[model samples]
Target chain A: MKTKKSLLFISYEEARHICDKIQYGEATRMEQIKLFIRISWCNISRKYTQKNTQLTTLCQSANLKSLDKDKKDSLKKMLESKMSESKD
Target chain B: MSSNTLDPTQWIDKYADYLYNYSVSRVSDNEIAQDLVQETFLAALKSSENYKGDASERTWLISILKRKIIDYYRKINSKKGKAEVRMSYNSDGDGDGDWMEERISDPHGNNAEEKIQNTELGLAIHECISKLPPKQAKIFSMKTIEGYETETICNELDITPSNLWVIIHRARTALTACLEENWF
Candidate 1:
């Protein structure tokens, strides 16, 4: 039996995009509902959602903080000048 | 010989954040952490020729960073001298003891086991991030780790919101897959 195509249904690709958005809290309520429905019976989408959720949890608990842009830029410039000086 | 080499100029571009995160977790100070990363890069540069391909570039740099961190602690300890603790007895024979705060667990210090776990997790995430395409890596880092706004990232990267989303989706998928094996 084939699952009928309907306007209300979302494709697995869109479901994945929505899953990514949901990770960042950017997914709208409607998108979340659609994703919820899609993965309810879709095995592939469900597996993707499970892994995506696990990834989000790992990132949150990692407690990682990146250096700001200014620091990174200055560090790069300092290394560049040092490298050039070494060659000379 | 295994094939691994150092690129001095890409040191900051590639490993600055990774090294910074590792050092900050250990040193618990941002300024000192940044200094250690810079010193590690410079030291690596001075000894670039001596680098054989036995270890990956990141691993070799980390070895140097570990030394820098240890040296930092040693210098501070030498400057301050060995810690002296004095447990005093009250002259009137009342209760007196060592520093009261030292007797208590530090609330702000965070639990040691959890901190160690987070540090390891953070390092793993950074390692995977390093393996991503340059643009994808930058966008993902800015959006996810640094928590930049979508519009802000788009304008900075000169890409539209949709394009940003596409890159993020790809990067996230790739990152999750990579981490699943190494981390989970």
Candidate 2:
């Protein structure tokens, strides 16, 4: 049981590091279990784990669309002129 | 003659939206994304003579855009007020230990309300990152947003793994506290 206990239990600081590694897909299964066990009792670490996951997900889906037609046109015209100037 | 010399004017109609979306995702600023996309086109024109047509026009434009984005981060890092911004964060006593004040339960992450909240939090998170010391911000985004491997980041940024971890932990702590203030 000594091995099991050491494998599952970890300090908060260690738990946080494992949590980050888990998110980054760098943690081993043993480390992931340790982090899960730690977060079960550690509210702060649990929140941190949740927030970190949310932040990454948000960023991946942060595809903000550009809808400024006028700006697009002006930029196009400016680029065209610049290109022509370079040619001449 | 080879048809390799792609016309510059066609880029706007063909790739502006794609390029703009890419830039905004990286930089998280609409105005700056627009400017960068435009700049990408200009760079393409300046280097037009180098178009050997081995790559597609879109591919060439994207290469130019990627360089522009790197330059944008470098420019921000070299800006004058970087030290002032870093000093604004409380770096005196216990490092980021003070940021661990309170923690709430995990919110349900996939419901409609949560999705809406994420949209708002996306902007807030970007703002939080921008407020960090420019170096921390750059490294954090490179790690998280760009998903660079740890060794690659350490080597490219010329930082040790421990140094990278410290910066990331601090950045995450500050961002958590900031998002809680603004969103939670």
Candidate 3:
């Protein structure tokens, strides 16, 4: 009778081989699944990152537009003050 | 946008095959694997400014792909109404009869060697891998199958070294058990 340890060792070796077969394309279904997951992941991340950049850009533009509006308001106030002082 | 400016398409042409092979090795599905690779390239191109060269371009792409895989599984399992179960073998328990019997039966049988030699072994492995819990399978495939160094795997997976080792050990043990039950 084989010891439990020996049996475990054999099983592990077999498992590694099984894993290798899948890795090397010896199994079609497994290969397909692997590919599918990878492709899906790549696509999802790509879209996610793209959206992130767009969002950032939008936020930056909004900030810039607000800043510009503030600048224009300040200029108008300065001109009004000078006109009032000259009229007085 | 210049005519000669390296674009996503050019990068795809250069790295698609490699990325495809790499993704296939992990997820084992052709269309999905290709999609992942394509997406990686697209993401890289869109976020090119974020590329700090801290990692190789390929490595950065793979890291993104890995995150995508995790998200996919999370979405899948959640949809199926199955709560993810995390199990660990204590390695000190009295060997369970079912586990021992499983080891003996070698469900894939002695013919496993022949199966391993067959080209379809890749597919079989992929199927088995898919059956694995998402994290375990990812770590196992990335480390053992993809031949990534442990440190790199840790970085890509965003896990600490100790956590990485623990996960790998659990993954290998689980895979071993799985093979015994299914592939023999």
Compute the lDDT of residue B71 as modeled in candidate 2: 98
Tens-digit lDDT track of model 2 for B39-104: 888778888888999887777888899999999999988885466654255566666654444133
Residue B6 displacement (Å), model 1: 1.6
lDDT of 1 by residue, A26-62 (tens): 9999889889999999999999999989888988999
lDDT of 2 by residue, A33-65 (tens): 788888889999898899888765656665334
Question: Where does candidate 2 chain B have its weakest 10-residue lDDT segment?
Answer: B98-107
Residue B166 local lDDT, model 1: 94
The docking category that best describes candidate 2 is incorrect
Instruction: List, residue by residue over B1-184, the lDDT tens digit for candidate 1.
Output: 7888777766776788899999998899999998999899889888988998899999999999999999999999897677775765345544345446445767667687787898999999999988888789899899888899888998888999889889998898999989988987
Candidate number that wins on TM-score, 1 or 2: 1
| Candidate 2 ranges beyond 4 A from true positions | A1-4, A63-88, B1-121
A best-first ranking of the candidates according to their DockQ comes to: 1, 2, 3
Q: Write down the lDDT that model 3 would get.
A: 0.50
Candidate 2 has a TM-score of 0.49
The TM-score leader among the candidates is: 1
DockQ values of all predictions: 0.70, 0.21, 0.01
Q: How large is the interface RMSD of each prediction?
A: 1.1, 7.9, 24.2
